[model samples]
Target: MREWHADYLDACNRHDLDAIRSFLSPSVRRAHLPSGSDAWIDDLAELFTAFPDWRWRRVQLIAEEDRLAVHLRAGGTHAAAFRGIAPTRRHVNVAEFAMYRVMDRRIAEYSGTGDHIELLAQLHGGLPT
Candidate 1:
């Protein structure tokens, strides 16, 4: 399961929704950030649609009983439209973190965070202050 976390990242990097979906349990529930802003991830296709070039790199994962905490640097060039914004063609890197709870060899829950302020700044062609 520890390696599967890495596999997920690789699949995400490739923007392969099918591969990413292969990792989900039927009961899979993923959260973008822990504050409960979103109820659930309906499908993997939408996940990749939102993050066209999402790549998780410099990953440090800790695997423990029933859970895995993954720390990563997520980045990509914005080549595709997202969130109603035109493509920025911008290379944005952000320090992102996530924790996954796996049950029965499939991810059951996930929570995550990142420097949104910095990402926005980069997207606007401004360096983070």
Candidate 2:
């Protein structure tokens, strides 16, 4: 699981959509991505566009049977619009948490959350007064 997940992260870091897709099941269930793997991939593409240098590093990982949990730290520079916020050219680092269920050596299901509030705050010059 560790090696597989590391390779998955490497694909993401490389922005290789095809490589990332190879790690997912055909019917993958992504809790945060309602439209399925395609949507999730599209979202990742959008993020890469917004943060051209985006990168994620695993901070923690736990594996049990067919399940795996991960904590990641993501950092990047804001180079384009994101969630309607114009580019601020700010650098942001945020935490992300995810849990995955692997089936047949591929990710069958997963759910995750990120520190979006902190990201927005950083992009917006430390939130509203």
Candidate 3:
């Protein structure tokens, strides 16, 4: 289970498109979207590109049945544009949570939330988005 969690974060931090693609199940769904995007793999890849140095830390995992809920804090220096904001070089930390449904011990769908508001606040100096 830890190995699975580590691989996901490693792919995220490295922004490795191949790793992301190879790891995803064809039916991957992201429940965070109102219309549950089926393009989770691509969306994840884009997010990492937008925040190239983005990294996850202090991860916690809970397992039940064929699913896992992951909690982690992500932080990085804002060296690139994100959420329509230009570079701020601001160090920001945000909480992240994801629930993954596994099929045959392979990830099938993921629902996630990230605190982008705090990152925007840090960049905009008191502005919250």
Candidate 4:
């Protein structure tokens, strides 16, 4: 599982959407996003467009049976608008955490949170009111 996850992260780091899609089940459910992998892929595409150099580094990973959890540090330069905020060309790094349920060696379901408040603050130069 560790090796598999490493490969998955590598694919993500490369921004290889097709490779990333190969790691997800057709019916994969991303609890925070829409119901399927297509929506998840679209979301990633938007992020890539907004931050062409976006990257994620794994801070921690834990696996037990069919479950896996990870802590990640995500960083990117604001080269394009995001979530109604215009580009400020600032770089931001934020923490993200996620847990996955794997079935048939593909991610079946997952839920996670990213430090969006911190990201917004970094982009806006301070916490928003």
Candidate 5:
């Protein structure tokens, strides 16, 4: 199970949408709680398009039976608008935590949290020194 999770993270780092989807069941139910969003598949496909160079680095991963929780950092240059924010062309890295519900060895649901304020601040002119 940990190996599967590692592979999924690797796929995310690679920004391979198809490879990432391979870890999801056909009927996967995705829940992006932070934004109150849901989907059957392609949950994060749009994010890739927004941050073309986005990447994730896992800080830690914990698994308890069918559920897995991960602490990680995700970042990329703001090359395009996201959630209505115009492109900033600045690099931003933010810490994020996510929980995944696995079913039949696939991710059936996912909920994550991140510091949007920090991200937004960075997009404007980066963090204050």
Candidate 6:
């Protein structure tokens, strides 16, 4: 399972959606906590469209039973509009944490939280003075 997480992280960094999808089960469910968005795959595809170079580097991975948690840093250049925010074309890095439930050696569900406030502040030119 550790190796699976490692490979998953690598796939994400490489933007290899094929590989990423291979590890996901048909019933997979994923959520972005900050935005309260739930999506299976289309949202992810849109994200990659917005940040073509977006990548996640795993800081740590922990697993207990069928649940796995990953700590990572996510960053990329803001090249397109996202979440109703126009592109600022700025590079942003934010900390993120995700938990996944594995069923039958595939990811069945995932929920993740990221530093969206910091990300938005960076996008909007460092918040209000």
What are the lDDT figures for the candidates, one per model?
Answer: 0.65, 0.86, 0.69, 0.85, 0.73, 0.76
Q: For candidate 5, report its TM-score.
A: 0.78
Return the lDDT, model 1, position 86.
Answer: 72
Ranking by lDDT: 2, 4, 6, 5, 3, 1
Model 4 ranges off by over 4 Å: 114-117, 127-129
Task: Give the per-residue lDDT of model 4 (tens digit) for 14-129.
Answer: 99999999989988988756777797788788888888999999999999999999999888999999888999898888888989998988899988884266788888888432
Ranking by TM-score: 4, 2, 6, 5, 3, 1
Can you write out model 2's per-residue Cα lDDT over 27-116, one digit (the tens) per residue? 888775664678778778888999999999999999999999999999899999998999988888888899999998888898888426
Residues 25-112, model 3: lDDT tens digits: 7666666542232366555555565567778884689988778889888877777667788887777777778888877656677777
Cand. 2 Cα-lDDT: 0.86
lDDT of 5: 0.73
Candidate 1 accuracy as lDDT: 0.65
lDDT tens readout by residue for model 1, 65-88: 988888788776777655555777
Give the distance in Å from residue 85's predicted Cα in candidate 6 to where it truly belongs.
Answer: 2.0
- Give the poorly placed runs of model 3, Cα more than 4 Å off: 34-38, 127-129
lDDT of 5 by residue, 1-129 (tens): 789988988888887767876787666544444222234223365566667898888899999999999998888887877777888777788888878889887777766674256777777676841
Please give the RMSD to the true structure for each candidate, in Å. Answer: 4.0, 2.4, 3.1, 2.4, 3.3, 3.7
**Per-candidate clashes, comma-separated:** 0, 0, 0, 0, 0, 0
Top candidate on lDDT is 2
Candidate 2 has which clashing residue pairs, if any? none
